[model samples]
Target: MSNINVDEVEEQMEEDEFEEELHETIRFLLVEFRGSLYTFTKHIANMNCERVHRPLNRRPITSRGYNYIHKILKEDPTNFREIYRMYPDVFLKLNNILREKTHLQDTRYICIEEMLAVFLLVVGHNTRYCLIRKTFERSRYNTSQNFNKVLKALNSIAADMMVKPGSAVPEKIRESTRFYPYFKDCIGAIDGTHIPATVFGRDTNSYRNRHGKISQNVLAACNFDLEFIYVLSGWEGSAHDSNVLTDALSRNNGLKVTQGYFFNATSLFNFFLFFRIIYSIHYCGVRYHLQDFTGQGRHPEDAKELFNLRHTSLRNVTERLFGIFKSRFKLFKTAPPFKYTTQTEIVLACAGLHNFLRKECRSDEFPVETEIEVPPSSSEQVYKDDNFGELFDTQEQQRTNTNAWRDAIANQMWSDYDHIVNKS
Candidate 1:
């Protein structure tokens, strides 16, 4: 018993010594070298015995934290060359939040550079763990395990940094609202987007609600500045946007707004008054309409010709919300090749990181393009009064459904719009 106790003490002391040595070594290295590709390679070779003899590339630098900075420069070469230059005050702000000595032990990927790199990957590429691993080969960690750890760590950190604990808005944002009155009463804008996934036959109908595919319903709430405030990304894709909102409202403690309202589309209803509805028209001609249900007649607003004309057009926050999110992260913009579980996590991580960068940016200039292809000619016909009423009546309907939430709420807000339209 005595010998065993002695050995245990010795092992603990050795661990402490090893930790101290590692820290000292990293500090020494930081002081010793300038961040050139050749110098970085030589430094890593000396410090990490596991690194192989491949010429240093983007991946290795990613592990070391230089590439995220490099990427910032590459993207905006005309504006800035150094990461520190673009975000001069960021390190100081981060240091105040992330105390240096606390997260320094037993973490290969905890450094500021690595965290930012992980954030960039999730939002910029939204790539898989395996692909990220291949991209940063110098990481001496299992791809999946490290990826999950990074995500978990980021969730806690970002939530702490960006989420205003007990309040839905972040501190900087709540304070900034004085200058930007659009954000004054607004806590966030809510919406749902579909993430594609594979479906099993047994679970086909469960995942195939009204949307027509196997997908996870991704629900997000962004502030007026378009930074994500809350993200709930794992509901079945077939789930209605209302259902997703219901889940998110119930899940997170901070998101439940007991007092105020937010903005969303008409798909969400009166139970959650937190949203100001964005009105849209869905026309189906009575004859060509393949749907089982009969039209109540033309919308009263259609008859009065006032639904589009009378109301003060509030900001289309939801449209801009989808545009900004998908624009920054291509993963959510297009259908992914991955199956469900992986797809959900990727989306969640991207949302979390979006909040992080939006907080970090000194300038809100999002890069205009990412080489993503857009249709040169939109095939969607504009709804003009002349033929629009006749046009939609001809379309086929695979599913005839009304969101229960929407039906319940429509009368409360748009009662005037409802009274004017005529029925079929």
Candidate 2:
């Protein structure tokens, strides 16, 4: 028999040790606090009822809470503290809004504040449900049995009460004043993003596609306020953003731009007269904006180029929404814990929350605008010729008209956006 490979044995041993440590760490419980829906109810009940309750003992806290808490908080102590302090106030405000909605029952159910607490805790800590059970020890929600129940309750409320369809343009969001005039014909900015999810499949074709990738393609739209207006989740990761957009547009009648525009990236192809697509083109490696009906790049230095820039600058509403949404929920930073079904629900819920916040706070006027570094100019980069000519034919009548309208609308909006940006 050959001599045993000591190096291989040591590597295997190390791997086993690492796995064991991970298992232990995941299961270990740190300082148990009393923060649960049951405890929450008890606190309310105690406030109203003339009953004496037994006081619970305080114990040394675990590193898990601090570790998870650190993950969500910003690096700068001052900034982190400021946001942390606002959590309670924001919770109360969101709760009051939910109460006003009439969707929640009046029978001493979970309040909106508690629901906000759950969201903040989940987004901030990215911790498990059971660990959250430990934080509110003094409250009525301490029972182990009610952990899932509370989560379900919060989910239901978020779905039914917090979210609203943004089909119609609100007066506040509607363009007004030349500095930032309402884009009357444009409905929303559309985009596709990747959110990680785990799925089981023996037949690779079931989930895998031409791209040979594994992830979910989430198509979401945001209004002018940088609020997520609509979400189309559950498309396979291999699906192109254009295909996802096509499916979403077909599925929802409201999404089909009958009178207004739906701005998207340049990858999306041309559509009919009713639906206008304003996208950007990458010329010489540098992304130049355009509103092309034929989906073809016409002139680099023409008025059309300026129109594309305006279109992109405005259409980028969805991009900012994506950044902020994922930054808040680190679960999106990596793959989601749940499968596709639950993942879709969570994504939609997050979009709703994103819009809810945008509606609640219209202006995020920060003082330190210059603190953020500006990206270096790429105007002089080497240009590559993307074959937009293959996508369209100039002889097509509808395509010609569509391009004309797109150009006109873009020119109008560009002047308006430029004024707004300049004033700011």
Top candidate, metric TM-score: 2
The C-alpha lDDT values of all candidates are: 0.48, 0.51
- Give the range of the ten consecutive residues with the poorest summed lDDT in model 2: 365-374
lDDT computed for candidate 1: 0.48
In candidate 2, stretches whose alpha carbon ends up further than 4 angstroms from where it belongs are 1-86, 97-116, 137-184, 203-213, 252-265, 269-300, 362-396, 407-424
Model 1: which ten-residue window has the lowest total lDDT? 304-313
Candidate 2 achieves a global lDDT of 0.51
TM-score of each: 0.50, 0.55
The regions of model 1 sitting more than 4 angstroms off are: 1-112, 115-119, 128-135, 139-141, 161-188, 198-201, 209-211, 252-254, 258-267, 271-312, 334-342, 367-424
lDDT of 2 at 395: 30
List model 1 lDDT by residue over 1-424, tens digit each. 9999999999999999999999999987876754566787777768753333455553342343334444553455444313222243553344344444224223443445444444445445656566565555535344444455545555556555444423455343356422123233345556566656656668867766353556677777665566666777777755656556666666645354434444433323323332322222222222211122235753333321222221112224444656666766666655565556666766766665556556786365445433221211222122223543443353212112223332333343354335433331
Residue 307 lDDT in model 1? Answer: 23
lDDT of 2 by residue, 268-320 (tens): 43332223444332122333533332255443334445555545666666666
